[model samples]
Target: MMRAILPTRALVPIAGLWRVTACMAGAALFLSACGATTGGPGVTPGPASPVVGAPPEPAVLGVEMSPERLAFTPPHLEGMDLVRVGVLLPFSGASAALRSEAGHLLRAAELALFERGIENVVLLPKDTEGTARGAEAAAEAAIADGADMIIGPLLAAEVRAVSGPARRSNIPVISFSTDTSVAGGGVYLLSFPPEEEVRRVVSYTAALGADRFAIVAPATPYGQLVSQAYRSAAAEFGGTVTAEEVYSGGVDSMSQAARRLARAGIGSLEVGRALAMTGEDWRPTDSGAFQVVMLPAGGDDLRMLAPSMLFADIDPLLVKFVGTGLWRNPDSAREPALANGWFAGPDAEMRARFETAYEIAFSEQPSRLAGLGYDAASLAVVMAASEGGIDRAVIEDPNGFLGVDGLFRLRADGTVERGLALYTIRRGQFEVLDPAPVRFGPDSMAVDVEPGES
Candidate 1:
């Protein structure tokens, strides 16, 4: 049996609908639902301003229920409508790390429910066990329990497995998979697609007069996707990829690929000699084969690749370095070769607030993907109380919705468009070069097809 935890005070409704507000650590975060617009900092309902020593207070909208207790059945409330949102995750899996990530996602979803203070919607969690078969079973169970919509089933394979069941039942699925192939029809991807990140970084670089570009990427599927995105984005920005290299195996292979890419872009021997003489302060007077080189690797691979570029005489000062969201790590900041490199990611300031709130709510740092859960659940809450309800048109609203991860909108094709910010690595830290756009414009909507999209 499930119990409804009623709010201590009644919420004052806005326009006959409950508005979502997250009061965190002395500040109020006003969030807009799909198709609605609010004014503020990064976009409308901008960066939250501090309320001068005020304590945190949860939003009072309606009754709240524990997700654990309402795992399968939601309690019936007389004269009140209930929206059942099925949350599919790999709660029980062979890999312990995946299971832990699943826990973080669930907790994040629950946090959104608590913060939004919406009692009309119930989150019904079902375990996928990290397999396609398990995902199908989970979807079946969730549907049987009268779920109006579904969230998650993380991997691309699991999303595909659940797609059929969800489509037949006319239930929309907001999955966490970055794979664009499974995105479209009734299933939407809420994950961060590398294509968008690549387009953002490339567009920013190109706008700064970088016409010639090069790339040294891994030979994996992820590498292929990013590499294709690089080509499309460069072309879209009126730039050309002059040199490209792919590598597999260990450090030696990566070094060789980096060497080949650097040598291909290196100027004449006289120029190299002059650069060597200038030492650490060297800046080439002439342009090389390419003005920018994109290294889409991160972590240890990035550490190795950066130095390898130096060994091949690829001066970071001469040729600009660019990367995707993978370069947004603290370790990447420490790499000397990546010091002036640029990358595109979410609004750092807003993301920091979310991290702080999550840590305080859950007593632990959330996984990188946990924001997806928070945003999805938050959207569900707003949609549940929406006059149009959780329909396809509302979910695919061109105006989009604003959440902890900045602003994002689900498209009819099931792809998502996010407002990203540009960051540069400098002095062992990541600094914002360009703030994320507060609102999406006509130009922002005109993006090229993703890797797997036709």
Candidate 2:
């Protein structure tokens, strides 16, 4: 008989009702479900924050459990080999925000097992408590418990903590953290990387004749990363960056950068015309020239800077506003100035299906990061059922694996590559500008269509 060892910490059951249904295609499982539940006092609830080199303790909310769970232990079958997978998450304490949707995440993974009909595998949960020390301890414990592979420890710090232990035990780890710096040494990152997002958008935009690009980003570390990615992608995509500007994240600095961007000959004709029509004192110091202006920031930051561009007489129609995956928000559409702006992100169709299934399975919307768990577990299931059984070669397959977010693969360097699609803000919604490729093409980007397509 299979045994499940629940965490010792008391966790109130999540309040709601959910119905789960699995879509099976041979050994692959796709989930579709119904229902919704808003979090209550007994559960951690918030958006996940980024974790860099080190993360300080953060305020936390109560941790809770769902009354229902997909069976992680498969039914016993004669002569079947058993595969053990471990999941590490922040179940309680300060870092709980990183895994506020643990219940939904677990359910999604379970749905994967159920749909695949893989009964010989077992998934064990370990609480990392949202700390590096906790992650190390949990990893050691999980490995002692006979886990053949490990799924997650949400934050980068936790992943770093668990990496040592996992490597020592010769066990592979698939982390959900987006921090690419922590990846490598048998630790495969399943989280989407900003580099991939930048490359996709840049390449696609360049193909469309928007070869002259300019970037305005914040001066933070993430901003630095984005700047580097923009430069690299520009070169790779045969694009020329006429100007690059970094600001200190202040309104004044952003406004000044906008002034400088306007002087770089970007959309000069339209800028002059718009200024003429506005009858404003503002005049183009130099003819604005770049066809594309990439803003690697989003949210209120974008909202703040977007208008500044127009104030500088940069016409929206003359210059295409390009951004990173951060621009994938409905609110971005509400910004009249950014209506036709483009960004790169996962496929919307797949995201909707996954979200619906998660709500139905746990009676609550899954965390934005929950798909990481589902995809990691799904890959684990697929590998476990294969003849090699989670071999290193299998995990590093360049062809990648299809998940709710679309096609993604792990690289030899432990980085992740996702097949992202281009999207544009249209009518207060994001519309697909280019479908995410399902397979790799000769250009090292995702193919426009699946194999055997006309």
Please name the candidate that would achieve the greatest TM-score relative to the true structure. Answer: 1
Index of the highest-lDDT prediction? 1
Instruction: Give lDDT tens digits, candidate 1, residues 138-212.
Output: 777677656788999899999999999899889999999999999987999998899999999888877767788
TM-score per candidate, chains pooled: 0.79, 0.76
Off by over 4 Å in 1: 1-73, 76-79, 268-286, 442-454
Candidate 2 Cα misplacement greater than 4 A, ranges = 1-80, 270-289, 442-454
- Candidate 1, residue 220: Cα displacement in angstroms equals 0.8
lDDT of 2 by residue, 192-291 (tens): 7888988998888777666677888898878888888888998887777788888896778999998988887654454566565522122223235676
For model 1 the local lDDT of residue 224 reads 93
Task: For each candidate in the order shown, give its overall lDDT on alpha carbons.
Answer: 0.71, 0.66
Q: Alpha-carbon error at 237 in model 2, in Å?
A: 1.7
What's the number of clashes in each of the models? 7, 10
